[model samples]
Target: MGGESNRWAASGRKATAVGTIAFRQQLAYKTDFALRGFFLLFILFVFIQLWTAAYEGDFDKAISGFTLKQIVWYLVFTEALTMAAPPLCSRIEEEVKNGDVAIRLIRPQSYVGYHFSVFASEALTRFAVHLLIGSAIAWPFVGPPSFGGGWLGLLALSAGALTVTFLLLLLVGLCAFWVEETSGLYFVLQKLQFTIGGMLLPIDLMPEWLQRVCAWLPFQAALYFPARMAVHFDPALLVKQLGIQIGWIALLAFAVNRMYRRGVTKLHVNGG
Candidate 1:
């Protein structure tokens, strides 16, 4: 039994190693990733131009909180941040629906850990690419954001925001165990987040009630809160938002673990 467990542990490490290698392999296609990044930069430029035109004359002086240049820079940061964001939750659901997850289940390793390891590896790779080349291009065109809070607080809040986003999506993916076909549902959810996640516009720019609603949703923590941390450095607000992000991460991680176990049981029962 001890020997068998050792072999199992070795196999798990091998699988995770393969996943890490595959992440690098995907990133090696520099042409594709660069093109995608370029498109993002181009889109930011177009939006900036439109906003610049709109803000001409009296509108320029009248606008209060964010100047035209600041808004342009916000678009730059928004593009970089969104590009670095993880893939949609639907990928895991697709794997389950297509029975691809069965292959992983046959291994001695934990399926949840394996998938998350793969995700984390890919996210790290992408983030590096974004910070290096992507940021270089965007930063020159637009100045860095003026953050109001302490740097450490903003960093902590950003970390919490990333954790919350990952956990929420993991929970969403685990829901596929019961729902079977969750792509359609995720599509609608994605649309909602795109519209209300405040990735496209600052929640502060929206109506008071809309901002209140955004505050409660997990989607806001995903992008808006982190972006706020980048631009506004209020430690008190950062602490409050970080607390919310941590709470969501904890709750979602627990919920997803339960769902994952239940799903595995169902898979075994169904003999899939």
Candidate 2:
């Protein structure tokens, strides 16, 4: 049993390395990595201006416990999370539609595992790019260091949230096996995530009931919870949010594995 477990760990590490290589190749060949910084800066600049204008009209210096600087920084973090997700949904849907799953099945790796590895490296690279550029763009407006020990906590939480994001998207993409196309579902999810996942605004700004609901759900944890942690720096809340985020990741990981197992059997039954 110990040997088998060790083997699995080694395979998972190998898969992650393969994924990192794949992303590196994609970045090298597909997009100009150098230009991504400027693009992210442009996007951040727009958000900063929007929030700055919003703050000007308000009399109180704080809105929903966030100052103007925190608000802009919040948008930056949320956008980084959103931008990090590779378009796994579209890729999976295409593969399923074109019967490419058959080819993937013959590979030496778990198809879903391979995809998850790719998702991990790609998302992390994109997240880092977005974070650096977003920070630079906000520096002149918001000024110096706004995070400390909370940075490490937020960093860990962000990793968990990114995992959850990838798993959910992969599951949604796998829906193509049954639905013939999953774009409609993916579209709905994207909109819901943007609105309720705390991409456009913080979860705290929502109605009290809605805030309570989002707190328990997976949406808020993905972006808002971690971003909130970064700026707020409550050790107690940090422990609570990390627990919730890890719990959600566990649940989502189980769901993804179950769905993938079922989908594989169905594909074999139908296509084999």
Candidate 3:
């Protein structure tokens, strides 16, 4: 038991190191970082204009339980979360096609863990950057962000959302093991996330039937719940949302693990 515990601890340290490396790699690409930041600003500016028009320049007007300011803030958070996600599916598919995954598999760390570390690091870095850019742009227009649930709650929910997103992307990427291309699958996944996942519009603002449908899907756990919680957090709702996020994360992680195990067995390596 002691030996097993030590092995687990070592794995944790390795994952952290891998994540740190990935984070630094992201920062190394200054051009890409600047472009992403600019793009985030543009997106926030467009959303601000659109939402302002929708509210007819009435910031205090409430639409579907969300004041214009709350809606703008919600969009800022949602868009940041959405844009922060790297093209993990495409990266995984490419690695699988080029046999890079075989090299990864031979490494000391678990292939899935390595990918998860990289994905989490990249996503968190981008998320933070996008959030800062969006917040800075949205602040003068929308005033301050709602702090109904406190910063800790927002951070916790954001972390859960990112984890859920990574697992889902991992599952989609692992499909490359069987299918020659996963881009179409990823495209569909992205659309679902933007539409029903609450990135494009809050679930509460959707039609009742659509809202009911989103409630059953895991997409909301990744986008809608966290964004909504940011704008109008309820303590009881936070507990419920966290519980749901945990459930989705558990299920998605299990799927990712199973897929990786089965997929790796089918992996073919050539020329060392």
Give per-model TM-scores: 0.80, 0.91, 0.96
lDDT of each: 0.68, 0.82, 0.87
For residue 216, model 1's alpha carbon misses the true position, in angstroms, by 1.2
Best by lDDT: 3
Off by over 4 Å in 3: 268-272
**Which candidate leads the pack in TM-score?**
3
lDDT of 1 by residue, 90-199 (tens): 77777777888888887666777676666666665665565455455545655554444534554565556566656766777777777876767667766666668776
Report the CA-based lDDT of candidate 1 relative to the real structure: 0.68
> Candidate 2, clashing residue pairs?
none
lDDT of 2 by residue, 64-179 (tens): 89888778777778888888888999988888888888898788777887888888888888898888878877878887546676577679789988988887798799898888
lDDT agreement of model 2 with the native: 0.82
- Name model 1 segments beyond 4 Å from true: 1-19, 57-64, 88-90, 106-108, 131-137, 146-154
| Candidate achieving higher TM-score, 1 or 2 | 2
The TM-score, computed over Cα atoms with residue i paired to residue i, of candidate 2 is 0.91
Cα distance off (Å), candidate 3, residue 271: 10
